[model samples]
Target: MSNDVEHAKRALRAELRERRQLLSDAQRETAAAAIGARLDALVDSIGARSISCFLSTTTEPGTRDFVARAAGRGIRVLLPITRADGLLDWAVATDDGEIAEGLHGLPEPTGEVLSPMAVNDVDLMIIPAAAVDRTGMRMGWGRGYFDKTIGSMQKCPPVYAVIYDSEVLDSLPREVHDQPVTGVVTPTQTLNLSQTRH
Candidate 1:
Protein backbone atom coordinates (compact mmCIF):
# COMPACT_ATOMS: atom_id res chain seq x y z
CA MET A 1 0.00 0.00 0.00
CA SER A 2 1.17 3.53 -0.72
CA ASN A 3 1.96 5.77 2.21
CA ASP A 4 -1.03 8.01 1.49
CA VAL A 5 -3.45 5.08 1.36
CA GLU A 6 -1.97 3.54 4.46
CA HIS A 7 -2.35 6.80 6.30
CA ALA A 8 -5.96 7.12 5.22
CA LYS A 9 -6.68 3.61 6.46
CA ARG A 10 -5.18 4.33 9.84
CA ALA A 11 -7.22 7.47 10.21
CA LEU A 12 -10.39 5.69 9.24
CA ARG A 13 -9.73 2.87 11.65
CA ALA A 14 -9.21 5.28 14.50
CA GLU A 15 -12.36 7.13 13.64
CA LEU A 16 -14.36 3.89 13.59
CA ARG A 17 -12.95 2.73 16.89
CA GLU A 18 -13.90 6.00 18.53
CA ARG A 19 -17.32 5.92 16.97
CA ARG A 20 -17.94 2.42 18.30
CA GLN A 21 -16.95 3.46 21.80
CA LEU A 22 -19.35 6.38 21.83
CA LEU A 23 -22.45 4.31 21.25
CA SER A 24 -24.75 4.15 24.26
CA ASP A 25 -26.56 0.94 25.14
CA ALA A 26 -29.87 2.26 23.89
CA GLN A 27 -28.32 3.53 20.68
CA ARG A 28 -26.60 0.22 20.11
CA GLU A 29 -29.83 -1.69 20.60
CA THR A 30 -31.71 0.55 18.18
CA ALA A 31 -28.90 0.36 15.64
CA ALA A 32 -28.81 -3.41 15.90
CA ALA A 33 -32.54 -3.66 15.28
CA ALA A 34 -32.32 -1.41 12.27
CA ILE A 35 -29.43 -3.37 10.89
CA GLY A 36 -31.31 -6.60 11.42
CA ALA A 37 -34.35 -5.31 9.59
CA ARG A 38 -32.28 -4.14 6.65
CA LEU A 39 -30.52 -7.47 6.47
CA ASP A 40 -33.80 -9.32 6.44
CA ALA A 41 -35.07 -7.16 3.64
CA LEU A 42 -31.95 -7.70 1.57
CA VAL A 43 -32.07 -11.44 2.11
CA ASP A 44 -35.70 -11.55 1.07
CA SER A 45 -34.92 -9.52 -2.03
CA ILE A 46 -32.17 -11.92 -3.07
CA GLY A 47 -34.20 -15.04 -2.24
CA ALA A 48 -31.00 -17.06 -2.13
CA ARG A 49 -30.86 -20.64 -0.92
CA SER A 50 -27.29 -20.44 0.32
CA ILE A 51 -25.13 -17.55 1.47
CA SER A 52 -21.55 -16.87 2.48
CA CYS A 53 -21.45 -14.29 5.26
CA PHE A 54 -18.91 -13.17 7.79
CA LEU A 55 -19.26 -13.88 11.49
CA SER A 56 -18.95 -10.32 12.75
CA THR A 57 -16.95 -9.50 15.83
CA THR A 58 -17.82 -6.88 18.46
CA THR A 59 -15.64 -4.32 16.77
CA GLU A 60 -17.75 -4.74 13.68
CA PRO A 61 -21.50 -4.84 13.19
CA GLY A 62 -23.31 -7.64 15.01
CA THR A 63 -24.16 -10.45 12.54
CA ARG A 64 -24.90 -13.30 14.95
CA ASP A 65 -28.59 -12.45 15.09
CA PHE A 66 -28.79 -12.17 11.32
CA VAL A 67 -26.87 -15.42 10.75
CA ALA A 68 -29.02 -17.30 13.19
CA ARG A 69 -32.14 -16.04 11.45
CA ALA A 70 -30.81 -17.21 8.11
CA ALA A 71 -29.81 -20.61 9.42
CA GLY A 72 -33.23 -21.04 10.96
CA ARG A 73 -34.71 -20.48 7.54
CA GLY A 74 -32.52 -23.23 6.01
CA ILE A 75 -30.01 -20.97 4.31
CA ARG A 76 -26.40 -22.16 4.33
CA VAL A 77 -23.92 -19.88 6.10
CA LEU A 78 -20.18 -19.58 5.50
CA LEU A 79 -17.48 -17.84 7.53
CA PRO A 80 -14.01 -16.79 6.41
CA ILE A 81 -10.64 -17.95 7.64
CA THR A 82 -7.52 -15.87 7.21
CA ARG A 83 -4.87 -17.91 5.48
CA ALA A 84 -1.15 -17.74 6.26
CA ASP A 85 -0.71 -15.15 3.53
CA GLY A 86 -3.52 -12.87 4.79
CA LEU A 87 -6.00 -14.04 2.19
CA LEU A 88 -9.46 -15.38 3.05
CA ASP A 89 -10.66 -18.97 2.71
CA TRP A 90 -14.34 -19.62 3.39
CA ALA A 91 -15.99 -22.65 4.97
CA VAL A 92 -19.58 -23.45 5.81
CA ALA A 93 -20.59 -23.15 9.45
CA THR A 94 -21.56 -26.63 10.63
CA ASP A 95 -24.49 -25.59 12.82
CA ASP A 96 -25.89 -22.73 14.85
CA GLY A 97 -22.98 -21.56 16.96
CA GLU A 98 -21.25 -18.60 18.55
CA ILE A 99 -18.32 -16.66 17.17
CA ALA A 100 -14.92 -17.90 18.31
CA GLU A 101 -12.10 -15.40 18.59
CA GLY A 102 -9.59 -15.81 15.76
CA LEU A 103 -6.96 -13.95 13.76
CA HIS A 104 -6.95 -10.16 14.20
CA GLY A 105 -9.38 -10.72 17.08
CA LEU A 106 -12.22 -11.28 14.63
CA PRO A 107 -15.02 -13.70 15.40
CA GLU A 108 -15.09 -16.99 13.46
CA PRO A 109 -16.93 -20.27 13.68
CA THR A 110 -16.28 -22.45 16.69
CA GLY A 111 -17.36 -25.58 14.80
CA GLU A 112 -15.04 -27.59 12.59
CA VAL A 113 -14.33 -26.11 9.19
CA LEU A 114 -16.20 -27.83 6.40
CA SER A 115 -15.03 -28.50 2.86
CA PRO A 116 -14.49 -25.43 0.74
CA MET A 117 -17.23 -24.34 -1.64
CA ALA A 118 -16.88 -22.51 -4.91
CA VAL A 119 -17.60 -18.80 -4.53
CA ASN A 120 -20.18 -18.98 -7.29
CA ASP A 121 -22.12 -21.50 -5.27
CA VAL A 122 -22.94 -18.82 -2.72
CA ASP A 123 -25.86 -16.69 -3.75
CA LEU A 124 -24.99 -13.78 -1.52
CA MET A 125 -22.14 -12.48 0.62
CA ILE A 126 -22.36 -9.95 3.44
CA ILE A 127 -19.20 -7.91 3.89
CA PRO A 128 -18.02 -5.78 6.82
CA ALA A 129 -16.67 -2.31 6.21
CA ALA A 130 -15.57 0.80 8.05
CA ALA A 131 -17.45 3.01 5.62
CA VAL A 132 -19.18 2.94 2.27
CA ASP A 133 -20.63 5.39 -0.22
CA ARG A 134 -23.91 5.45 -2.10
CA THR A 135 -22.09 4.23 -5.19
CA GLY A 136 -21.09 0.94 -3.49
CA MET A 137 -17.48 1.87 -2.84
CA ARG A 138 -16.30 0.31 0.42
CA MET A 139 -13.53 1.32 2.78
CA GLY A 140 -12.35 -1.80 4.54
CA TRP A 141 -9.69 -2.38 7.19
CA GLY A 142 -6.90 -1.95 4.55
CA ARG A 143 -5.98 -5.65 4.46
CA GLY A 144 -7.42 -6.33 0.94
CA TYR A 145 -8.52 -9.79 2.11
CA PHE A 146 -12.00 -9.46 0.63
CA ASP A 147 -10.65 -7.93 -2.54
CA LYS A 148 -8.32 -10.87 -3.15
CA THR A 149 -10.90 -13.46 -2.16
CA ILE A 150 -13.66 -11.95 -4.27
CA GLY A 151 -11.33 -11.55 -7.23
CA SER A 152 -10.78 -15.30 -7.31
CA MET A 153 -14.45 -16.10 -7.61
CA GLN A 154 -15.61 -17.07 -11.11
CA LYS A 155 -19.12 -15.80 -10.44
CA CYS A 156 -19.13 -13.03 -7.93
CA PRO A 157 -22.02 -13.22 -5.52
CA PRO A 158 -24.19 -10.25 -4.75
CA VAL A 159 -22.00 -8.41 -2.28
CA TYR A 160 -23.84 -6.61 0.52
CA ALA A 161 -22.01 -4.29 2.88
CA VAL A 162 -23.35 -4.06 6.44
CA ILE A 163 -22.84 -0.73 8.09
CA TYR A 164 -24.59 1.83 10.25
CA ASP A 165 -26.46 4.48 8.27
CA SER A 166 -23.94 7.00 9.52
CA GLU A 167 -21.12 5.03 7.94
CA VAL A 168 -22.59 5.63 4.49
CA LEU A 169 -20.94 8.84 3.54
CA ASP A 170 -20.67 11.14 0.53
CA SER A 171 -17.43 9.53 -0.68
CA LEU A 172 -14.40 7.65 0.51
CA PRO A 173 -10.85 7.75 -0.80
CA ARG A 174 -10.15 4.72 -2.95
CA GLU A 175 -7.16 2.65 -4.01
CA VAL A 176 -6.67 0.23 -6.91
CA HIS A 177 -7.12 -2.80 -4.68
CA ASP A 178 -10.33 -1.52 -3.14
CA GLN A 179 -13.29 -3.71 -4.07
CA PRO A 180 -16.81 -2.25 -4.45
CA VAL A 181 -19.93 -3.78 -3.04
CA THR A 182 -22.88 -4.68 -5.29
CA GLY A 183 -25.25 -3.44 -2.62
CA VAL A 184 -25.20 -1.67 0.74
CA VAL A 185 -27.45 -2.31 3.73
CA THR A 186 -27.82 0.10 6.57
CA PRO A 187 -30.37 0.05 9.38
CA THR A 188 -32.57 2.36 7.35
CA GLN A 189 -32.10 1.32 3.73
CA THR A 190 -30.74 -1.21 1.26
CA LEU A 191 -29.20 0.32 -1.83
CA ASN A 192 -28.91 -2.01 -4.82
CA LEU A 193 -26.09 -1.22 -7.20
CA SER A 194 -26.51 -4.20 -9.50
CA GLN A 195 -29.24 -2.38 -11.38
CA THR A 196 -27.59 0.99 -11.07
CA ARG A 197 -24.08 1.69 -12.21
CA HIS A 198 -21.72 3.37 -9.74
Candidate 2:
Protein backbone atom coordinates (compact mmCIF):
# COMPACT_ATOMS: atom_id res chain seq x y z
CA MET A 1 0.00 0.00 0.00
CA SER A 2 1.17 3.56 -0.68
CA ASN A 3 2.02 5.74 2.28
CA ASP A 4 -0.83 8.11 1.46
CA VAL A 5 -3.35 5.25 1.32
CA GLU A 6 -2.08 3.75 4.57
CA HIS A 7 -2.39 7.10 6.29
CA ALA A 8 -5.93 7.59 5.01
CA LYS A 9 -6.96 4.15 6.27
CA ARG A 10 -5.55 4.91 9.70
CA ALA A 11 -7.39 8.22 9.87
CA LEU A 12 -10.64 6.58 8.82
CA ARG A 13 -10.25 3.87 11.43
CA ALA A 14 -9.77 6.44 14.15
CA GLU A 15 -12.79 8.39 13.01
CA LEU A 16 -14.96 5.26 13.03
CA ARG A 17 -13.81 4.18 16.49
CA GLU A 18 -14.74 7.59 17.83
CA ARG A 19 -18.05 7.65 16.05
CA ARG A 20 -18.98 4.21 17.37
CA GLN A 21 -18.39 5.37 20.93
CA LEU A 22 -20.85 8.22 20.46
CA LEU A 23 -23.78 6.01 19.47
CA SER A 24 -26.46 5.39 22.08
CA ASP A 25 -28.14 2.03 22.65
CA ALA A 26 -31.31 3.21 21.00
CA GLN A 27 -29.41 4.62 18.08
CA ARG A 28 -27.60 1.34 17.61
CA GLU A 29 -30.91 -0.53 17.62
CA THR A 30 -32.30 1.86 15.03
CA ALA A 31 -29.27 1.46 12.84
CA ALA A 32 -29.51 -2.32 13.06
CA ALA A 33 -33.16 -2.18 12.03
CA ALA A 34 -32.34 -0.05 9.04
CA ILE A 35 -29.54 -2.38 8.05
CA GLY A 36 -31.79 -5.42 8.42
CA ALA A 37 -34.48 -3.84 6.28
CA ARG A 38 -32.04 -3.04 3.52
CA LEU A 39 -30.61 -6.53 3.68
CA ASP A 40 -34.11 -8.01 3.38
CA ALA A 41 -34.67 -5.96 0.24
CA LEU A 42 -31.40 -7.10 -1.27
CA VAL A 43 -32.20 -10.73 -0.51
CA ASP A 44 -35.58 -10.34 -2.15
CA SER A 45 -34.08 -8.73 -5.23
CA ILE A 46 -31.44 -11.41 -5.71
CA GLY A 47 -33.67 -14.42 -4.91
CA ALA A 48 -30.59 -16.33 -3.87
CA ARG A 49 -30.94 -19.88 -2.61
CA SER A 50 -27.79 -19.79 -0.52
CA ILE A 51 -25.91 -16.91 1.14
CA SER A 52 -22.85 -16.47 3.33
CA CYS A 53 -22.51 -13.73 5.94
CA PHE A 54 -20.72 -12.89 9.14
CA LEU A 55 -21.95 -12.84 12.69
CA SER A 56 -20.97 -9.32 13.61
CA THR A 57 -19.24 -8.52 16.86
CA THR A 58 -20.13 -5.60 19.06
CA THR A 59 -17.59 -3.30 17.46
CA GLU A 60 -19.02 -4.07 14.01
CA PRO A 61 -22.52 -3.59 12.67
CA GLY A 62 -24.63 -6.44 14.10
CA THR A 63 -26.23 -8.78 11.56
CA ARG A 64 -27.32 -11.77 13.65
CA ASP A 65 -30.97 -11.01 13.12
CA PHE A 66 -30.53 -10.83 9.40
CA VAL A 67 -28.69 -14.11 9.34
CA ALA A 68 -31.43 -15.77 11.34
CA ARG A 69 -34.07 -14.40 9.05
CA ALA A 70 -32.26 -15.76 6.00
CA ALA A 71 -31.85 -19.15 7.61
CA GLY A 72 -35.51 -19.25 8.47
CA ARG A 73 -36.34 -18.52 4.87
CA GLY A 74 -34.31 -21.61 3.75
CA ILE A 75 -31.13 -19.88 2.58
CA ARG A 76 -27.96 -21.73 3.42
CA VAL A 77 -25.96 -19.24 5.51
CA LEU A 78 -22.20 -19.48 5.88
CA LEU A 79 -19.86 -17.63 8.24
CA PRO A 80 -16.15 -17.01 7.89
CA ILE A 81 -13.67 -18.64 10.23
CA THR A 82 -10.23 -17.15 10.72
CA ARG A 83 -7.68 -19.86 10.11
CA ALA A 84 -4.28 -19.99 11.81
CA ASP A 85 -2.58 -18.35 8.82
CA GLY A 86 -5.01 -15.42 8.82
CA LEU A 87 -7.05 -16.74 5.92
CA LEU A 88 -10.83 -17.31 5.92
CA ASP A 89 -12.70 -20.64 5.86
CA TRP A 90 -16.45 -20.76 5.44
CA ALA A 91 -18.68 -23.02 7.52
CA VAL A 92 -22.39 -23.58 7.33
CA ALA A 93 -24.47 -22.15 10.16
CA THR A 94 -27.82 -23.90 10.51
CA ASP A 95 -28.69 -23.04 14.07
CA ASP A 96 -27.24 -21.36 17.16
CA GLY A 97 -25.63 -24.66 18.13
CA GLU A 98 -23.10 -24.61 15.28
CA ILE A 99 -21.03 -21.58 16.33
CA ALA A 100 -17.90 -21.50 18.43
CA GLU A 101 -14.87 -19.28 18.95
CA GLY A 102 -12.16 -19.25 16.33
CA LEU A 103 -8.84 -17.43 15.95
CA HIS A 104 -8.53 -13.75 16.87
CA GLY A 105 -11.60 -13.89 19.12
CA LEU A 106 -14.00 -14.12 16.17
CA PRO A 107 -16.80 -16.67 15.88
CA GLU A 108 -16.50 -19.86 13.85
CA PRO A 109 -18.22 -23.19 13.64
CA THR A 110 -17.70 -26.02 16.06
CA GLY A 111 -18.24 -28.45 13.18
CA GLU A 112 -15.64 -29.64 10.71
CA VAL A 113 -14.09 -27.21 8.19
CA LEU A 114 -15.59 -28.18 4.88
CA SER A 115 -13.73 -27.91 1.59
CA PRO A 116 -13.76 -24.46 0.08
CA MET A 117 -16.82 -24.09 -2.08
CA ALA A 118 -16.85 -22.67 -5.58
CA VAL A 119 -17.74 -18.99 -5.76
CA ASN A 120 -20.66 -19.91 -7.97
CA ASP A 121 -22.00 -22.02 -5.08
CA VAL A 122 -22.22 -18.88 -3.06
CA ASP A 123 -24.83 -16.52 -4.44
CA LEU A 124 -24.02 -13.71 -2.03
CA MET A 125 -21.30 -12.87 0.49
CA ILE A 126 -21.90 -10.16 3.05
CA ILE A 127 -18.56 -8.64 4.03
CA PRO A 128 -17.65 -6.65 7.08
CA ALA A 129 -15.86 -3.36 6.49
CA ALA A 130 -14.50 -0.44 8.46
CA ALA A 131 -15.36 1.81 5.57
CA VAL A 132 -16.25 1.71 1.89
CA ASP A 133 -16.27 4.14 -1.00
CA ARG A 134 -18.90 4.99 -3.60
CA THR A 135 -16.67 3.18 -6.07
CA GLY A 136 -16.98 -0.09 -4.01
CA MET A 137 -13.49 -0.36 -2.51
CA ARG A 138 -13.65 -1.86 0.98
CA MET A 139 -11.45 -0.92 3.92
CA GLY A 140 -11.44 -3.93 6.21
CA TRP A 141 -10.15 -4.05 9.79
CA GLY A 142 -6.49 -3.81 8.69
CA ARG A 143 -6.43 -7.56 8.09
CA GLY A 144 -6.10 -9.17 4.66
CA TYR A 145 -8.39 -12.12 5.46
CA PHE A 146 -11.21 -11.14 3.12
CA ASP A 147 -8.78 -10.14 0.39
CA LYS A 148 -7.02 -13.48 0.46
CA THR A 149 -10.29 -15.37 0.72
CA ILE A 150 -11.90 -13.61 -2.21
CA GLY A 151 -8.71 -13.80 -4.25
CA SER A 152 -8.55 -17.59 -3.99
CA MET A 153 -12.04 -18.17 -5.33
CA GLN A 154 -12.20 -19.43 -8.94
CA LYS A 155 -15.44 -17.56 -9.55
CA CYS A 156 -16.09 -14.70 -7.24
CA PRO A 157 -19.53 -14.32 -5.73
CA PRO A 158 -21.40 -11.05 -5.63
CA VAL A 159 -19.84 -9.34 -2.61
CA TYR A 160 -21.89 -6.95 -0.53
CA ALA A 161 -20.60 -4.76 2.26
CA VAL A 162 -22.52 -4.46 5.52
CA ILE A 163 -21.87 -1.20 7.35
CA TYR A 164 -23.48 1.80 8.97
CA ASP A 165 -24.47 4.58 6.60
CA SER A 166 -21.94 6.97 8.11
CA GLU A 167 -19.11 4.59 7.26
CA VAL A 168 -19.79 4.87 3.52
CA LEU A 169 -17.68 7.61 1.97
CA ASP A 170 -16.97 9.26 -1.36
CA SER A 171 -13.51 7.66 -1.57
CA LEU A 172 -11.11 5.46 0.36
CA PRO A 173 -7.44 4.76 -0.27
CA ARG A 174 -7.06 1.14 -1.45
CA GLU A 175 -4.29 -1.26 -2.34
CA VAL A 176 -4.19 -3.77 -5.19
CA HIS A 177 -4.89 -6.63 -2.77
CA ASP A 178 -8.08 -4.99 -1.53
CA GLN A 179 -11.05 -6.51 -3.38
CA PRO A 180 -13.80 -4.14 -4.41
CA VAL A 181 -17.37 -5.04 -3.47
CA THR A 182 -20.18 -5.52 -6.03
CA GLY A 183 -22.56 -3.48 -3.92
CA VAL A 184 -22.69 -1.72 -0.56
CA VAL A 185 -25.75 -1.73 1.71
CA THR A 186 -26.01 0.64 4.59
CA PRO A 187 -28.98 1.67 6.74
CA THR A 188 -30.05 4.10 4.03
CA GLN A 189 -29.30 2.85 0.53
CA THR A 190 -27.79 0.07 -1.55
CA LEU A 191 -25.30 1.45 -4.07
CA ASN A 192 -24.90 -0.86 -7.03
CA LEU A 193 -21.31 -0.74 -8.26
CA SER A 194 -21.78 -3.06 -11.28
CA GLN A 195 -22.91 -0.06 -13.35
CA THR A 196 -20.98 2.61 -11.43
CA ARG A 197 -17.43 3.51 -12.40
CA HIS A 198 -14.86 3.13 -9.67
Alpha carbon lDDT of residue 169, candidate 1?
80
* Candidate 2 TM-score, C-alpha based: 0.90
Number of clashes in every candidate structure? Answer: 0, 0
User: Once superposed on the true structure, which residue ranges of model 1 sit more than 4 Å away at CA?
Assistant: 114-117, 194-198
Q: Ten residues in a row with the worst lDDT in model 1?
A: 111-120
Each candidate: what lDDT?
A: 0.76, 0.79
Candidate 1: C-alpha RMSD to true structure equals: 2.4
Per-residue lDDT over 63-144 for candidate 1, one digit per residue giving the tens place of the 0 to 100 score: 7787888888888877887666867666666545766677777777776565344455888889888988767788887777
Candidate 2 regions with alpha-carbon error over 4 angstroms = 118-120, 194-198
lDDT of 1: 0.76
lDDT of 1 at 149: 72
TM-score against truth, every candidate: 0.89, 0.90
Screening candidate 1 with a backbone cut-off below 3 angstroms (N, C-alpha, C), the clashing residue pairs are: none
Q: Which window of 10 residues has the lowest lDDT sum in candidate 2? A: 111-120
Winner by lDDT = 2
